[model samples]
Target chain A: MLRGFLVLVLFFLLGEALQKVFLIPVSGGVLGMMLMTLTLMFKGGISDDLASASQGLISVLVLLIMPGVVGVFFTADQFAGQWLAVAAALLGGTFLSVLSTLWLMSRVVRLGGGKGE
Target chain B: MARVNDWYSRLLSLPETLSASPALAIGLTFGAFFAGNAVFRRIGRPLWLPPVVLSAVLLAAVVALLGMDYKAYQQGAHWLTVLLGPATVALGIPLYQQMHHIRALWRPILVTLPIAATLAAVYALVIAWSLGATPEVLASLAPKSVTAPIAIGITQQLGGSVPLMMGGLLITGVVATLFVDLAARWLAISDDRILGFALGLNGHAVGTARAFEISPTAGAFASLGMGLTGVFTALILPLVFHL
Candidate 1:
C-alpha cells in the first residue's frame, strides 16, 4: 500500500513538473493519470500494491471533494440574480449531454461494429 | 454565584476556542461524512441523497451553527482536498484495467470522446449565454463536466472562480446521474458500458460512482470516460478560448 501511494505521488509530482515545464493545459494530476496509464499499458498489468492503494483513495473521493463543494457558501453572491440561468444551464445541459452521449455512443457501437455491446 | 458565572462564561467561549483549532475542522468534516454515510445507508441510498452531498449540506449547517468561518474550516479541510491530486492520478488503475476494452474499441472511444465532451461544455455555455450568465460564470461552467480536481484546474486557467466551478461541478454530477439512469431506462439501453460511459462523460465522479454500483464493467468504462474527458477538455478548452 505504501509503495502504491509512493508511486502515485511520484507520478503526480512528475506530472506537475511536466505541466509546469511544458505549459500543459491539463492539471498535473490529470497529466499524471495519463502518464501512469501509459506506463501501465507498457508494463502490461497493475501491481497489487498500486491497485489496492488506488482503490483506497478512489473510494473516499467524495470526502476529498466535499471541502470544495462547501465553497458554495462563499459563492452565494455570484449566484444572486443569475440563479435561474445557472440552474437552467446545469440541469438542462446535464440532461442534454447525457441523452446525446447515450444516443451517439449507441449508434457508434452499431455502425462501427464496436464491442461495447 | 461567581462559580456559576465562571462556568457559563467558559461554556460560552468553548465554541470560539474550538473553532480556532484546526483539528476541529478536520474532525467535523470526517464526523459529518461518516454520519452522512450512515444516514444514506439507513435510508436505502436514494439517488438524490449521495453521501457527499449530505455531508456537504450537514457540514455547512454545522459550520453555520458553530459560527465558524469557511476559511477557518478550510484550514483543516484543505489537507483532505490535497489528497484529490493523488486520487486523480490513481484513476490510472481503473483505466488500465479497461485496457482490453480500449484495445477493442479505441476508435469508437476516441470518436465519441471529443463530441461528447465538447457537447457537454457547449450546451451549458449556450444555455447560460442565452440566459444572460456573466462571462466568468460561463468560464466556470465550461469545465463543469470534468472531475473536480481537473475542473478546478481548468477554472483557474480560465480565470474563473473555483468556488463557482465547484458548485457547477457538484450540481452537474447529481443531475447527470439522475438523468442518465432515467434516460437509459426510457431508451431501453441496457449496455453497462454505454450507460457507464455516458454517466462518466456527463456526470464525472458522481456518475462514475453510480456506474460502479451497476457493475464493475460499467465502473471501468465510467473511469475511462471520465479520465479521457478530463484530459480532452483540459487540453482543448483553453486553446479554443485563445483562438
Candidate 2:
C-alpha cells in the first residue's frame, strides 16, 4: 500500500510539473490520472498494493473534499449580490444536464436497437 | 525541582498547545465526519443528508462557534486536501477497469460527452447571465459541473474567483445528487451506465461518489464520465475563451 501511494504521488508530482512547464489547463491530478491510465494500459494490470492504496484514498474522497466545501461558507461576499442567480443556475443547469444526458442516451440506445434498461 | 515545575507548566498549557497545532484541525474534521457518518447511518442514510454535507455543515458550525477563521482551520486540514491530488490520479484504476464498457459505447459516449458538457456549461452561464450575474460569476459558474481541482484550474483560466467556483461546484454537486435520481425515475431511464455518466458529468466527484453507492458498474462509468469531461472541458473551455 505504501508503495502504491509512492507511485501515485510520483505520478501526481510529474503531472504537476508537466502542467507547470507546458501551461496545461487541466489540474495536475487530472493529468496524473491520464498518465496513470496510460501506464496501466501499457503494463496491462494494476498491482494489488497500488489498487489497495488507491481504493483507500478513493473511499474517503468526501473527507478530502470537505474542507473546500466548508471554505465556501467563508466566501459569502463573493455571492452576496447574486445568490439567486447562482441558485437558479445551479438548479436549472444540473437538472437540465441530467435530463439531456438521460434523454440523449436513451434515444441513442433505442435507435441502436439496444434495451436501454 | 525545576524540571518537575517545567513539566507541570507544560501539562497546564497542553490544551492551548494542542489547539494551536495542526492536529486539532485534522481531529476536528475526522471527528465531525465520523460523527456525521454515525448520524447518517442512524437516520438510515437519506439521499438528502449525505455524510459529507452533514459533516461540512457541522464542521462549519463548530468552527463558527469557536470563532475560528477558515484559514486557520485549513492550516491543518490542508494535509488531507493535498491527498486529493493522489486520490484523483488513483481514479485511473477504475477508469481503466471500465475500458471495455467505454469501448463498447465509444460512439455514443463520444457523441454525448461534448454535447452534454457544453450544454451543462452553457445552460448555467446563460441562466446566470439572464439572471444578472456578473461576468466573473458567470466564468466561475462555467466549470461548476467539473471536478473541483479541474474546475478550479478552469475557473482560473477563465478569470473567475476560486471561492465562487468552489461554491458553485459544491452546490451543483449536492443539487445534482438529489435531483438526478428524481430525473432518472421521471425519465424512466434505468441504465446504470447512462445514469451514472450523467451523475458524473453534471455532478463531478460528488456525483461520482454517489454513483459508487449505486453499484460498481455505475461507479466505473461515473469515473469515466468525470475523467473524460474534465479532459474535454479543460482542453476546450480555455481555448474557447481565448478566441
Candidate 3:
C-alpha cells in the first residue's frame, strides 16, 4: 500500500520535473505514467505485486465520475433555458466527429484491402 | 439552525416538520441516476448508457420541481465529489497491467504525445475563442477534451466556473467520441495507436469508452491517452490559463 502511494507521489513529482526540463505540453503525472510505463518496459514487465496493486486502483476508476456528475447539478439551469443552443452544438459536434471516424475506419479497411478483413 | 439554513442547506430541509438528513438528498440524486441508467439501458437509448449525463438531467428536473438550490443538492452530492481523487489514483491498475504493451511503444509515445497534446489544446482554444467565448471560458473550454475530474481542477485553477467547465468538458468528451475515429478516417488516419491515443488524450473518458468499444488494444491506448492528457493538462493548463 505504501509502495503504491510512493509510486503515485513519485509520478506527481516527476511530472513537475519533466515539464520544467523537457518542455512537454502534457502534465507531469502523464509524463510520470510514461516514465512508469517505460520503467515497466525496461523491466520487461511489471512484478505481479506491482501489477496487482495498479490493477486494483484502476478497477473503480469509473466511480470517480461521481464528483463530476455533481458538477452538472449547477449547470442544469443553463441547459434548461438554452437547451436548443446546447443541443445544436452537441448534435453538430457529435455528427461531425462520428462521421469522420467512420469514414477513416472504412478507408483504413479499403487500404488494407490486400489483407483479409 | 439559521447558519444551517443560510450556509449549507439540505434539499429536504423541512421547516414545519424536521428530518435533518443529507442522506435523503443524496439518495434522491443517485436514485435519479440509477433509475435513468436502468431505463436508458433497458430501452436501449444512445444517451442513456452514460448515466452520468442522464443522472444530471434527472437531478436538475427534481431540483426544479422541488425548488431546491444547486448548493442544497450539493450537500449530498459533495460526498460523491470527494471520491474523485480515489477514483483517479485507482486508474493506475489497468495501466500497470498494460505496461508491457505500453513499453513496446515507448518511442512512439514520447514522440507522438507532445504533438497530439499541442494540437488538441490549441484546437479547442481556437474553436472556443473563434466562437467568441471570453478568455476565462476559453481556458475552461480548452481542456474540455480531457477527463472530468482533472479537467474540472484544471479549469478551476485557471479561473473558469467549475460547473461550466464540467459541462464543457462533458460535452467535449461526448463530441470527441462521436467524431475522433471518423475524423481520423477522413484524414486517412491508419495507425490505431495514433488514432486511438490521440482521441483518448483529447476526449478523455468518453473517448476511452468508445475505444474500448472498438478493441481492447485500442482501449489500452485510450487509457494511456487519458492518463497522459490529464498529466499534461495538469502541468500545462496552469501555465496557459493562469497567465
- Specify the highest-DockQ model's number: 1
Quick one: best lDDT, which candidate?
A: 1
Query: What class would a CAPRI assessor give candidate 2's docking?
Result: medium
TM-scores of all candidate predictions against the true structure: 0.95, 0.91, 0.68
Relative to the real complex, the DockQ score for model 2 comes to: 0.68
Stretches > 4 Å off in candidate 1: B1-7, B19-21
Please give the TM-score that candidate 3 achieves against the real structure: 0.68
Candidate 3: tens digits of C-alpha lDDT, residues A1-117: 557655655665666587679876554445566667566556766555555555554543444454455566566664344444444444454444344333433444455331322
Q: Candidate 2's residue-wise lDDT over A33-74, tens digit each?
A: 999999989999999999999999999888888887888788
Best-first order by DockQ: 1, 2, 3
Candidate 3 ranges with C-alpha deviation above 4 Å: A1-63, A70-117, B1-20, B45-49, B184-192
lDDT of 3 at A111: 50
What DockQ was computed for model 1?
Answer: 0.79
When just chain B is superposed on the true chain B, each candidate scores a TM-score of 0.94, 0.89, 0.81
Task: For each candidate, report its DockQ versus the true two-chain complex.
Answer: 0.79, 0.68, 0.24
